[model samples]
Target: MTKKIYWAAVIYTILGLLGGLYYRELTKAKNFTGETQLAILHTHLLALGTLVFLIVLVLEKVFALSETKSFKPFFWSYHAGMVITVGGMAVHGTLTVLGKESGGAIAGIAGLGHIILTVAFVLLFAGLYARISDKQPVKAA
Candidate 1:
């Protein structure tokens, strides 16, 4: 799971860099809206894709998943959400580049995916809080 998160982070970072470079070139060509969408793409990749994935990865290591089974579901949920969210952003971003405002199948799916991603973030937060706040009886030495 840690490996998966790291790989996702690396991939997302690379894509974000590419998007940035593309935005730079577009800006040089005076393509304003293209630059704006590319900026959004960069943020989406870095924040939702890289940052959230890293947080989950560190939490997995810190929490010791081998000792806890329940966390698996939350971790999977967050990861899945990030995947779908990033995938949607990629499709929608590309479409936006083509001068399409909205009203397409991919656009609809992308919008739904963003909502799922937000829900996933909330679930992850709840799971972490629950895990940390649970009390375990202590044995006195």
Candidate 2:
């Protein structure tokens, strides 16, 4: 699980760097000087994907979090949410750069991603709390 989480972080870091490169090159090609969602995709992937996975890796070391019941659900949910969120942003940004108007559906889909992430966070905390509370206290003889 630690290796898996670490690999996830590495993958996300590479993706984030690619995203940034895409944004720069695309904007340059389009001569787009204004703001676009592409600008944030890089940061979002880095922060939410890479950094969050690293934190989880540490937590797993401390708590053996992967053994918890909710860990699997949280992991899947987090990845699903991240993919949906990043996909939406990429599409929306591309449309914006191309001077195309997008409807509310895209925004709603991206919001759904956020909602999933929120639920995943709750699951992680619940698991962490369970781990902490299950620990027996040291005796003071």
Candidate 3:
């Protein structure tokens, strides 16, 4: 997870910067709808790609659940969700570049992917939190 987050941070940073530039171009072209939608996608990608992944990595390290049953599932799900979400966002971005008003399939897929990825991350976080905090010390130091 730590390694995953490190890579994600690098990729996300690049993606975010490029997305920002695209957004500026959209604004300059007076394409408000495209700008807004792509902005949402960009923000989502940036947040999940960097912040959320890092948080998960920290949680994994702090909990020391390398061999735990939930660890593998959590890791795989998060990454899989990321792939789908990112791919969908890319599709949407391409379509946006082509000047599509409705956004076609990309919009629907991106929306769905975002929802799924959000849920996957939440579940992963919850599982890690539960495993770590479920047992409390009977006595404090």
Candidate 4:
């Protein structure tokens, strides 16, 4: 599980770098007015997705978090939320750049993604709390 999380972080980092490059080039061309939104998507994907997974790796090691019951759900929900949220942003940004308006459906999907992210975080925190509370006190060396 820790390995999977680390790999996910690596993948998201690569994706974020690519997205940054894409945004730079697109903005340079002045063909995509919605490049800013794509940039936001890129940041969120790297920060929330990549950074969060890295944190999870640390938690797994420090707290043995992956052994908790909540780990699996937290992992799946968070990744799914990231994908949906970033995908919605990409679609919406593309449409905007094309001078097209996005309907309520796109916004709804993004909203749902955020909601899932929130739930996942709650689960993660709950698991962390459980592990922390269960920890034994450190003894002097």
The most accurate candidate by lDDT is: 2
Candidate 4 C-alpha lDDT tens digits along 1-141: 779999999999998887777667766676665434677877987899789888889988788787777889998999898888888887777666666788999988989999999999998997898788875322233
Candidate 4 lDDT for residue 100: 79
How well does model 4 score by local distance difference test?
Answer: 0.81
lDDT of each: 0.63, 0.90, 0.64, 0.81
Tens-digit lDDT string for candidate 3 (24-118):
67666764554445566567667877776666667656665433455566666666777777677656665665666544576677667767767
lDDT of 1 by residue, 80-99 (tens): 66566666666665556656
Off by over 4 Å in 3: 26-35, 93-97, 102-104, 133-141
| Best candidate according to TM-score | 2
Candidate 2 global lDDT: 0.90
Output the TM-score of candidate 4: 0.88
How well does candidate 2 match the true structure in TM-score terms? 0.93
- TM-score of each prediction: 0.67, 0.93, 0.67, 0.88
Quickly count the clashes in candidate 4: 0
lDDT of 2 by residue, 1-141 (tens): 889899999999999999999999999999998888999999999999999999999998888888888889999999999999998998899889889987899999999999999999998998888788985222233
